[model samples]
Target: MIEPSDGAPPDSGMTLVEVLVAMGLFGVLASILLGLGLSTQAVTEDTRDRTGVNEEARIAMERIAREVRQSAGLDSVTLPGTPAGHTSTSFTFWTDFNNDGARTNTASDPEVMTYEWDPDTEELSMTAVTGLATVTRPVLAATVTSFVVEPRSSRWQYDQVGGACSCADGITTWRELDNSAVGNYNSEPDPQELRFADLLFVSMTVEDGNGTQTYSTQIDLRNRS
Candidate 1:
């Protein structure tokens, strides 16, 4: 058919411009995919951080609840409200935290426990003295922003005598135990009249670099009573 036309048929192949356009579209899609992947990674990291903070708070709060429910001698619940030479800002306490309400004097069973937070360092440290037993537990590794312990006593009375605590002198300032606070149970006139079946309130707050979290619990101290 008339020697092959010098110019090839019209629709044989795409022009260079068309190919370039297709390549550009593919690149755009790839860029979108990359952006989505980065976003997902960031979300996962944030969730992990929040979960870790919650677990730490939960562990510490649970430990405290268990010990409190089994608290035998509320009278001996020594909370260091002020540091030795410090003012009312310093609050610490030593009480029976074991499942058994018995106080341990020897290294085997430590009955006395102390919880304190250093305002300057923000460190929450725990010291326990059982019968021949000594154990120190840390509540937080970093600087603690806040720490508070309110006893849920059935009796509104607090021992407000200005004298040195049994553990150490040079430290005075005690309040009569009371249960007026909600989630607390110091409303009972006589502790002996109250049973272990009674309910008590517990609240706590903890903070880290990221943020702060609070824990509230109601427990029956009969087992520890």
Candidate 2:
């Protein structure tokens, strides 16, 4: 090393105070980045959960609609015992899977289909009859909170000259069927009138870790009209 000239200052590195300040600033920046990352992760997880619930609800509704559309007529609908009586939990109908356009019931062939909602299990199940054997399958697994099926009738009276005639028009209007109305129809004197409903309204509610979603659909019976 060479000797310094008179009144010249010595060169040196950063002091301890400067190093401490720099380290503190770096730590603060790191913490801010970490917080932002955590928040983004949380938001993504919530969106995923919500999307799952919606997808499940859509699939379930589609399955029910497809089966209902193939129904020949409504067999029966059962509601839970409640004062309000706002929900129906089970439904049975005749489905023409073979496209025969008619209901069939023989020792070797059966066409009854039933949809049941089990509150205890939070599941929706379907039962089909083939000949003398009955097979039951779970349509939707747990997480289903409610399943309701409502049937409505549409009757028309044709204008006959100057008087009204008993002829159903091709157009049909749908409405929610109540328990009392269902019971009255079931007690009809004619067995042919037991399956009188022309349209069905299917609704369901699903709940998951994210949230709850409700879906509704309308199905028209092809063979009924």
Candidate 3:
């Protein structure tokens, strides 16, 4: 080895101080990289979970809409909305699965269907009733937050030939009647009221550890003015 004129010692390996400083810097860089990696993983997992929740909610809504679109008319819509009645997390209607489109809910052929969403169980269930046998089954097991059923009903429009309002049958405007904020309908509606229910509105919400998704749609009944 060659030394400078004023050099006291020759070149050597790294000193203890240099080694310690290098190690500290390396440790900090490792920690930062690890933190960034963990954060990215967390975000990816959250996105996946949220997407799953949205899909589940969508499927459920579609199933309900499909059945309701083929329904004859509304039978019973639970409380806390129009057609007020005792509070129940369920709605009953006449399914036109049979050949006839009769809006009847008798215990004869299991044509009557009821959809119930129990908040306590966080699940949706369906019950079909008939004189012979009554069948009940689970529709889906989801974290449902709310399941609301609303009726789109209407009354006939009277004569407007001379700006005169007539209750007598002339021509059907097919406009919904605004009797009250809640309407003059309720559970166990009369035959006329049942016929008035031309549309069924359903809204649902699903909430899980991931997030919440709301789905709503209005389905038309078979009845036409």
Question: For each candidate, what TM-score against the reference?
Answer: 0.56, 0.67, 0.69
lDDT of each: 0.52, 0.66, 0.65
Per-prediction RMSD in angstroms? 9.9, 7.1, 6.7
Give the number of the best model, judged by lDDT.
Answer: 2
**Arranged by lDDT, best first:** 2, 3, 1
Candidate 3: clashing residue pairs, number = 2
Off by over 4 Å in 2: 1-11, 82-88, 100-111, 130-133, 156-194
* TM match of model 1 to true structure: 0.56
Q: Higher-lDDT candidate among 2 and 3?
A: 2
Clashing pairs in 3: 83-186, 107-131
Residue range 94-196, candidate 2, lDDT tens digits: 7777778766665455678788888778888887776667878887653888887666555322112122434644433222122223333232212243355
Output the better candidate (1/2) by lDDT: 2
Q: Please give the distance, in angstroms, between residue 150's alpha carbon in candidate 2 and its true position after superposition.
A: 1.5
| lDDT assessment of candidate 3 | 0.65
Tens-digit lDDT track of model 1 for 85-112: 5421222223454544445555655556
Write candidate 3's Cα lDDT for 11-118 as tens digits: 688999999999999999999999999999999988887787788778877877777777766666654433454445677776766767564445666767889887
Query: Number of clashing residue pairs in every model?
Result: 39, 0, 2
